[model samples]
Target: QLMSVVAVGDQLVQQQHFGAERIQERLQDTLGNWNHLLDLAALRRKRLEEAVDFHQFFADADDVDIWMLDTLRLVSSEDVGRDEANVQSLLKKHKDATEELKNYASTIEALHTQAGQLGEQDRTAPEVVERLNSIDHRYQELLELAKLRKQRLLDALSLYKLFSEADGVEQWIGEKDRMLQTMVPAKDIEDVEIMKHRYDGFDKEMNANASRVAVVNQLARQLLHVEHPNCEQIVARQNQLNHEWAELREKAEGKREELNSAHGVQSFHIECRETISWIEDKKRILQSTDSLEMDLTGIMTLQRRLSGMERDLAAIQAKLDSLEAEADAIEAEHPEEAAVIRERITQITQIWEQLTQMLKERDSKLEEAGDLHRFLRDLDHFQAWLTKTQTDVASEDIPGSLADAERLLNQHQAIREEIDNYTDDYTKMMEYGENITAEPSTQQDPQYMFLRERLKALRDGWQELHQMWENRQQLLSQSLNLQMYNRDTRQAEVLLSQQEHVLSKDDAVMNLEQAENLIKRHEAFLTTMEANDDKINSVVQFAGRLCDEGHFAADKVSKKAENIADRRNANRERALQQMEKLKDQLLLHQFLQDCEELGEWVQEKKFIAQDETYRSAKTVHSKWTRHQAFEAEIASNKDRLVRVQQAGEELMKEKPELAELIAPKIKELQQQFQ
Candidate 1:
């Protein structure tokens, strides 16, 4: 529009209108000056905005540069720490500085952005790029220096941790070593056993300490590998710990050996004293002087006593031999006590020999007295004949057939008749013995009392023979009659024997499958036994009925029936017990299996719960989200854990024996869960 106006004005000027040329020239000049002033003002505003941007960049960069210098000084400090507490304090300060530096990351980023904008407006602004670069370089240096300082402080803290741990273990070692020095040598077997048991507990603790020390050493090695500042101190602490531990072990081992030796020596002394006391008792008995009897009975009694003493002496001799063997072992291990042990053994052997000699002399005196008595010769012959007759009576077995049983009965009758004939002879001998004892000279003699005793024994033996013959005759007759009635009794006996063998088996159940199989097998066997119940009952009833009918073998039949009934009842009870035991075992096995499965699931959850690798998330939000998910999983699974605990408690309430096995597992799981 202005150009159109200028063109119209020029045309008017050319037409020579009044003042057209002057107005056109003045409009051109005025338009030119207005355009120049507008351009100048626009130029001035652009320059002012650029100046603001540059000064803003400078202000931000200078602030960051000042921070870098201060942080550099802080990071560059050579002081690691004076001690653990000091190191921790310095570490905390370094951590705060590191966080402050991290906060500056955004400020530095904003500076880069502003510098980029400035560079884009004018590529020649090298100052902005150079200042930004300088600030970036200083920030990176601060980061590295801060990192180095933090690491140094951490290394110092780790070194102190080693010192603390090693000091604690060394203190424990010192206490234990003092305790070991106070442990006196045991005076007896029981004392030694107690001491050794306590020592074993210490040994276990020492083993655990060894592991702790190993961990300390391993940390020391790690620090050394990193070229820790206190290398010499770490080496010194490591060597001191290892050396103290070695010394403690040496002292413990020496005490163990000493206790063992003392135990062996004390055991030998106690056994030796007991043996000597026993020998003295035997000697007193041997040396006793009761009035001697010249009668045959007294001589025989003396001989029997001598024979028993000889047997006792033989047993004592065996004990001495064992003691000698033990002493040999003790001497081999502990030679210093060999003399005392040998002397005690020698004393025991001498006393034992003296007792043997005493026994021999007593035996010889009894033998000589026996030779002087004429009545002893006859009494010996009679006793020999009596023993033979008793053997014949006692040797009869149950007859297999009726004829054989009847024959045995007839033979028993003849033996009874012979015993009756001997009864008269026994009476005459007793009269003769009484008459000899009635003589005044014989009455005054110690042998007279022995004569009366001999007579009484002969009469008792004669009576015992009569009673034994009568019993044998009765048994033979019963056998003859029992042959016909033994079929039912024999069948029950055979069945009981078979069932006894079956019930005797005691196989152990090892697993759920085995327990179940055993229970099934037992149930089947019980079923079979149940089916045989009627057969067993019928046999008992039949025998009982025969007894009620006054059968010839009624007594024997009744006894046999009662025995069969008792055995059948016993076997039934046993079968029921076996089935119950198997079922219980199966229950136990199933419970253990369920517990094992639950334990494995709990263990899996524990492994996941104990994980500390959430730092894998690069951002705080990612880490927080992952942790929240983890917490949710734990909360969801809590009910499952509670169910496991409830199940364990219920199982313990139901089966008390399982409490011994499962309580510890439950408690451990509960602790880990907490």
Candidate 2:
């Protein structure tokens, strides 16, 4: 039991030692873990210090450093796991260090934020002091600005109060000077100087206001003393002036309208002169009344002048009406002459309107005199133009050729346009003549008589030329037709000659049908030639001769064909008789020669009888003579012997007894032939 106890004690000691080693190992691991945590914290703090410029926040950086040292000491110490109290204390210290580090980091972040806000990498005391000094200086300046603003407000209020009343300007000036003197020492020199300038401006403004007030007072007094005109009296005077001016203006307007309506310059100028005189008289009277100084005598005098002008205007108008009526009578008597005279008068009137100012510059009274001179000049010019126009019309020639006609037509169109252009001018002149006070000279007034004569001549001449051209064209057409007819007739003649030559062949009978067709074609050409005989008589005659020749040739060829046919018939008849006789003789000779069967010799006899050489032998004697002459020819022929032998062989093959009976006879004949 003691040994066992001793063994247990040893086991307890070993177990205790093992537990101590394990505890040491565990403590070492905890220390390592803590060191690792410290390392992380150190790295974080270092990065924070570098990135955030932690030295700028010295307090926060120092606190973080102390926390780091405490953390390091706690982690490095060996008493961490000595007891529970020690362990608790170590944990508490670590926790406190962690908290301290967190707090330091927060403080550093806040300082960094502040540095960022200040736009500074290092928030040093010098920079802070400099900023504070700048703020202080700005505050001083603001305070000075506030004081100056307050003083300016006071001055403005004082000036406003002073200027409010008219009687306070002088007292305000005195007060402003005293206040400036008082402010010289207490205020900034600049503020004092500004106040002085404001004071001077206020003084000047007050002076100007005083002057304005004095002027206003003076104007007010003057207004009080001035009296307005009586409304009724002034209105009455204006109405009277208006009535008088209206009377004069109405007269002048009537005269102007009348003068404008007058076609003649003489009447127009006279009316214008009276109207202008009346207007001048009215203007003089109006000037007298413009100053409100018109009297009854002046008005009566104006009325008298106006009355005289009216009387004169009425007399002139009456004379103008009478002259116009007489001119109308004259125009009715000779309308064309009156028209020409009026045209001249209108031209003169136009010249008067254009040169009125120029003439007036030469002579004030030239309004009438110039119109007279212009009328005379235009009259002479118109007469000369009339003479020239008559001559031009008489000289106008008719167009000769087509091109000349076209040109003359264009010229005629141009002249018509010119006449149209003259219409307005001529009408205006006629109207002027109707309004003229005098009669115009009428030496020669041909009007458009010469133009009409020339137009008629041109028309007649053009008609004649057109007829000539038409005749020439017709002649040319006839000549062309004649030429075409001649060409066709010659072509028909050539065709007829060819047809005749074709008919002349020995086969005229065969070609007779074709020749008849050609005859029909030739007859058609002859018909065409006859139809156009008037155009091509020579060609038609030549074509007629060719047609006659073709007909005669065709008749001759037809008769020859008929005679040849008759001769052929006769010859055929005689050949048939001779053939018959030759056949009979052949049969008789064969019978006489004791050959009843002549076989192929009968066909040979028939063929020889129809031969051309014996064709003309119509008599039996002649045929016999021919046969006798051919007998010698038959005897010398080897072909005849071979033919006879072949015939005898065929006869033997066909009829052996008959052949045997004829063989002797054939042998005899063969012997005779040999």
Candidate 3:
């Protein structure tokens, strides 16, 4: 109604009616006063309701607080069970208690809500607020205690469950371990196969139980993840389970490998036996027919049979290789029996090798027998060639010249080449004779004795022929050396005579330049003379060597060497005298030239020192430094001057004739020095 009146007044005022403003103001003032009175009356009613609510709140709060105290005592109880069953039973009761606490949650919330309402109504009422806070505090404590109690129960249950599960797994592992430990190893193939089949099933069963063990591990991990009170025990149980599980697996795998190796070894042994029997049979066949027949047909039959046997042996080799591989694997799998197994393998291998050897020897003997007639034909041919070669090698013709001797040596070498061409035939025949004589059946044959005698005669003839060829070759080589020596001696003597004639020439030098040229010419002449001397010495040495080697012309070579040595000594002495004369003239010329050079150097230094450029202050120090360097240079040339003077004096003494030549240079140099 007041809203409608206010709406009507607002419309009249907006329309500017005559009394609308006055009436609106008066109505607003009256409503204000009425609202103030209603506020007072509401405050009075709220106080009355708050008094009643405060008492009721206290009552509900006290009730909840009392129940919480009892619940706290129950939650704080240390009655965690010692076993799975006990813990499980306690867990169930704790669960029921938890449910009851949850049921009371709403009632407690309601009372809390009431307290809030009462406090909201009268904020100055500390007692009501305090009581409400105390109830809330107790409620929170009860909740935490209950939660902790439930966790403890759960921890205990989980611990017990883990223990139970771990015990079961351990029991299972132990049972399996004992079974594996106590199992009898297979002794044969059949037994191994049966055992392997059973172990496979057992392994699968063990693998299937792995999930059960995993469950136990998962339970333990959960307890650990949550940090259960029995964390130490949980970890210990987990480690033990893991250790035992690993060990059990190891044992199972070991047993499996053991059985497998047993089967492989047993199979290997059986195959080895079969291979051995086969090898023995083949060996007997080889031995029975090992005898060689004198006829081609019989020998061919034996060869074909041996070839067939070899093919069979080759086929059996694959089986042996397989058996060996199997044996290796078994040995790798089981080391304790490796030696025995390998010994057996080695014995069988030895037998196989022996059979192979027998086959090889038989084949060789057959081949040798087949080659007998060819051997005899080659022997006869070789013997005839040896006899003819002996006649050629033993020829008594002596070479008289280098060409003849060289021709003879070349002919001997050709004979040697021919002998070399038949060397393989000779070796083959000798081997044939030895083979025939060495055979047990043929040892007493007259043909064998003849072959032996023929071989001995051939060897002796070959040795004699070789020695004859060597002797003839040595004679021819020595004849060639003698001819070379004679030719070299003649040539050396001619060269020495030419060089000696050159050295005896009367060459004269006019001036220093002419003397230098003459000295160079003399040096050249001496070089030529030295070469001639070397040649003559070589001739003499060659003659001496020929004498040492007992050459047929040693006496002639010695006389030629004496003549050549005399000529060589005379030429050398004359050449030395010529060189000394030329050198003395050259020295005189060099001394005169040195004296002239020293005089010029002295004059040059005197000119440089006589300069007067040191008068200026600015140029004084530099000029003095240059002047001092010039003086030091002149001082250094004093040695050159003294050396030149001494050389001039020495030349004047050595050759009094050169004193007239170098006296002016020495005097002028002395003047320059003074």
lDDT of 1 by residue, 1-674 (tens): 87777777778888888998687787789789879989999989987888888788898788888878888899999998877888989988899999999998998998788776763554247777678778888889888988888888898899999998898999999999998987787666888878878888988998888998898899999999989988999999999999998999999999888887787788789889999898898888767624556454466566545545666777788899899999998889878878988999999989888887877777667667643343454555566678788888886587888778877888887887777776665666667677777777776566677667767887787777777887787677666657745765677778888888989999988899999888888888888888877778887777776666566678778888888889999999998888877877776677667656666776786676567664566899998887899788778767766776787687779878778876886777667667
Clashing residue pairs for model 3: none
Best by TM-score: 1
Residue clash pairs of candidate 2:
342-429, 342-430, 343-429, 343-430
Deviation of model 1 at 20, angstroms? 4.7
TM-score of 2: 0.16
Sorted on TM-score, best first, the list reads 1, 3, 2
Residue 120 in candidate 2, Cα distance off native in Å: 99
Pairs in clash, predicted candidate 1: none
Estimate every model's Cα lDDT from 0 to 1: 0.79, 0.45, 0.80
The count of residue-pair clashes in candidate 3 stands at 0
Residue 653, candidate 3: alpha-carbon lDDT: 90
TM-scores of the models, in the given order?
A: 0.49, 0.16, 0.38
**Model 2: ten consecutive residues of lowest lDDT:** 292-301
**Candidate 3 per-residue lDDT over residues 46-120, each given as its tens digit:** 888887877877777778878888877788899999899999888888888878887888987787677667746
Highest lDDT: give the candidate number.
Answer: 3
Better of 2 and 3 by TM-score: 3
Stretches of candidate 1 off by over 4 Å are 1-20, 77-100, 119-123, 150-154, 186-198, 217-236, 288-315, 322-343, 366-674
